[model samples]
Target: VLAFTATGFVVAAFGQALGIDTLVVRNAGAIILCLVGIVLLIPRLQDGLSRIATPAAAWASRQQSALDDRAGLWGQALIGALLGIVWAPCVGPTLGAAVALAAEGKDLGEVALVMAAFGLGISTVLLVIAFAARGALARWRGRMMAAGGRGKIVLGGLLLIVGIFILTGVDRQLEAFLLDHLPDRVTEWSTAF
Candidate 1:
């Protein structure tokens, strides 16, 4: 978890572009994310997974559920980390595009610094969403339960958009916009630190 972004930074430092592998990872991750969202949103698929669980090992499923229940916040944190892992690839194109821009006519330290910041930003968002949403959902259990199915479907559609964008190499437009809008002071600070 800690080294995930550092790995990206190191790669950028080496100027090694695993262009195809990165695309593969981004696409596969997107597809899997969409599938997860679909399974959660679709009653039929959800029921099918439950049915599959039953024949595989009824007691194991129940025991796992119990363990999840008992593990509480720690379990939730682990799940959050897993979610971050799954979704990390969705941001790959953006990060890569950003790092490349930052690396252009720059030294290795500068490239790494940019990538490290991007990685921290990505990690922070995932962690915040995971923890904050958990609390919010607990408070709004009834409303959330009602909207949960629809939410997952919306999320799935969003994932598909991100996936398609990366696959098509359209994320560079977003990267361009971000770089254009980034304040000069921020760039100065990034350089200074």
Candidate 2:
């Protein structure tokens, strides 16, 4: 999550520095996200993606093994950080869009905050699953993988729907409405941050 947050911030900053039009970036990001959803929904596309990613994964595995043989705990940490840097962007479309949206404000702090919050949310869920459901997950691992396939489809459809919302500008309208209706204290707190 930390690595993701840092990468997200840099991406936002780079986009801003390039003077890219916000609407264009937002639309492009939405389209990319929708494409990712489509890829997820299609097994053939996933297989293709896997083939493309296999080399990278294999390299990472080898590096992990070498690190384990040499650098001990510190090497493991380094490899983990390297994986996070590489892995985050691949899995970051949802939060990437959020950070891109936040970038429209031209506020680096806001972008960082959004990325941090998103990372924290993901981390919390993963930690909870790792710690609280380890046994149950191990017992049901096979079943869970089957269910996970269905869950991926559902998630893909939802991403498609959200992409449409963002593209159609409904997301902005909803955000505006929420902001308009937010309590003064909430608004004030956010601004203060």
Candidate 3:
């Protein structure tokens, strides 16, 4: 996730340096399109199609075993990285904003810090969930299982909504709204940069 986010920042910075208008919004749209494509193309993901359709038992077992292992901090970091990569599709908006900022061609230090902040924000939520996951899973295994059964339906609905938003150009509307409402000072600053 860090790597991906950093890559996005760099791309954005490069775009800004080139004086690209709407760099953020265009790139964000592209990223979302990429995610949609990946989800459609990946056989495993397409087959599962829903949280309920996922092999929760097997996944939970694996997570439990991995957590129980006496690994060092590096192992945890690696696991976290892997998890972030796997979860990237779900984190599109946050990353897209960070990258758009990076494209504004900020100083290297600033860019690094911004990317780090973005990573930290994402990691915070994930870490909290990971910490409580085991207990939550154990206590609500039955309910979770039932939820899983309806996972595909939920996922399909979400995908439908996302598709409609994208196809109907809602992103452009959002971009226009933001740009129209930005403080004059910020717009001036962006142009000056």
Candidate 4:
């Protein structure tokens, strides 16, 4: 996850250096995220994807096998970097704004720190879910199986809502509101990180 976020930061910096419009890239990312959520939410979309899934899966498997045989830890790192590109949409809008700030000649260290924090936050949640929630996940998996993909629907709804919020600029408003309401010290502490 650190690798993923770092890759994103590097890519954004490179893009900015190249005179690319980071805002446009960010908007495109939001659209991609929305499309992913929509695909998950719509059954027909899933059905359409399923048609291509087999061939895609076969090719992916073959690639994975080759990577495993040839690359070891480096292969995993490469995969993480690739995932960073594939999941750029998953980076919250704050990072997008941060990238913009960097492009505007604000401190690059601040942007890197934000990306690191974002990566850590995601990693922590995944760790907690993987370790602390193992038993709960097992039970939830059973229930999900019985529920005929209610789980997917619920997750999809959440992703869709978040995507819409980010795309519509509601997230920036929320962030501003929070900053306005929160203690200065609290905000400072986050920056200190």
Candidate 5:
């Protein structure tokens, strides 16, 4: 995850410096490519993916639950990194600005800190969701499993839409809009470094 974040930050910074209007598009495209790579390696990910990518039709299949086991943090972290890379297109905008700033190629330590902070920000939200919404997610997972092939199709379609949104540069537009309308304090802080 750190390596992926660092590479993304560098790409964002380089794209900004070079006046690349298609940075988001290219990044999204890269994300799609990464997902393709993962899909191609499904044999390797089968065990981990099976738990997360539950078939919708089997929503009520009474599968064994392991949400609270907490026995595989390192393994989970590795899988999470792989998942992050595969889903980058859907959430690229989540760190677009921070990445752009890190890409400025300022101090190496500063860049590392900024990337770390970004990772923490992401992790904080996910942890909160995991803790606070476990029941809801489990229910949703059941529903997804019940939906089965249809559920999978819907997910695939959603991914396609996300891909299209990224390819169309919606994220960049949103980023620009936010930057343009940022509050004075945010603007000042963002410009400080």
Candidate 6:
């Protein structure tokens, strides 16, 4: 995840150096996010994904365990890495914004720090949920299973709001407003990091 974010930062900085316009990027990202949101919110698409997932799971279950414990460990790590990329749409904007901020400095060290911080922040949430996942899943399995079909709708609703904000420029404006009003102490603390 750290590597992924670092790469994003580096790429953004490179793009900036090549004279790509930030406004163009912001608009493009907003449009893509909105489209994704629309697709997710479509009931038919959710139904299609569900239909496909079942057969795919059954096929996977039928496959023999080809890997020993050691290989299995590495295979799982690889799968997790791939899954992170698959999940990037959910996180791309925040990372992009951070990358753009880092690019302003044109300093490789600053870009690395921004990327590291972004990765660390995201990993913290993931770590907390992962640590508590077993218990949560065990306790809520039946309920979660029951609600599975609706989960996509819930996620879509959230993404729709985020997309709307980004599309209308409210998201960036709000971020800028917050930054302007933020306490110097807080900014200083972050800089200390």
78-176: candidate 4 lDDT, tens digit per residue: 887787666655665556756776777778777777777777787789878789877887778867686768867877787788778878989889989
lDDT of each: 0.65, 0.77, 0.63, 0.76, 0.59, 0.69
lDDT of 3: 0.63
Residue by residue across 54-127, what tens digits does model 5's lDDT show? 77526533321232244357655655676656554444544455455555556655555655666667778988
Query: In candidate 4, which residue ranges exceed 4 Å CA deviation?
Result: 133-140, 146-148, 173-193
Question: Which residue pairs in candidate 6 collide?
Answer: none
All candidates' TM-scores?
A: 0.53, 0.65, 0.55, 0.72, 0.44, 0.66
| Number of the top TM-score candidate | 4
Tell me the tens digit of each residue's lDDT in model 3 across 1-193.
5764555455446645666455455456555655655565454776666665567867976875686585657666667677655554455555455555565544656665656676777668987999979688899999989886577556655665565566677867976897899998987896553
Q: Model 6, 96-149: lDDT tens per residue?
A: 666666656657666666666766788799999899897889999999988975
Between candidates 2 and 6, the one scoring higher on lDDT is: 2
Off by over 4 Å in 3: 1-5, 14-76, 82-90, 174-193
Candidate 2 TM-score to native: 0.65
Pull out the clashing pairs in model 3.
12-103, 13-102, 13-103, 52-148
Would you list the clashing residue pairs of candidate 1? Answer: none
Of candidate 2, the 10-residue stretch with the lowest lDDT total is 87-96
For candidate 6, give the lDDT: 0.69
Q: Which TM-score value belongs to model 6?
A: 0.66
Which has the higher TM-score value, candidate number 2 or candidate number 5?
2
Error of 3 at 85 (Å): 4.6
Candidate 4: deviation at residue 128, Å?
Answer: 3.9
Q: Count the backbone clashes (under 3 Å) in each candidate.
A: 0, 0, 4, 0, 13, 0
Candidate 1, residue 110: how far the Cα is off, in Å: 2.2
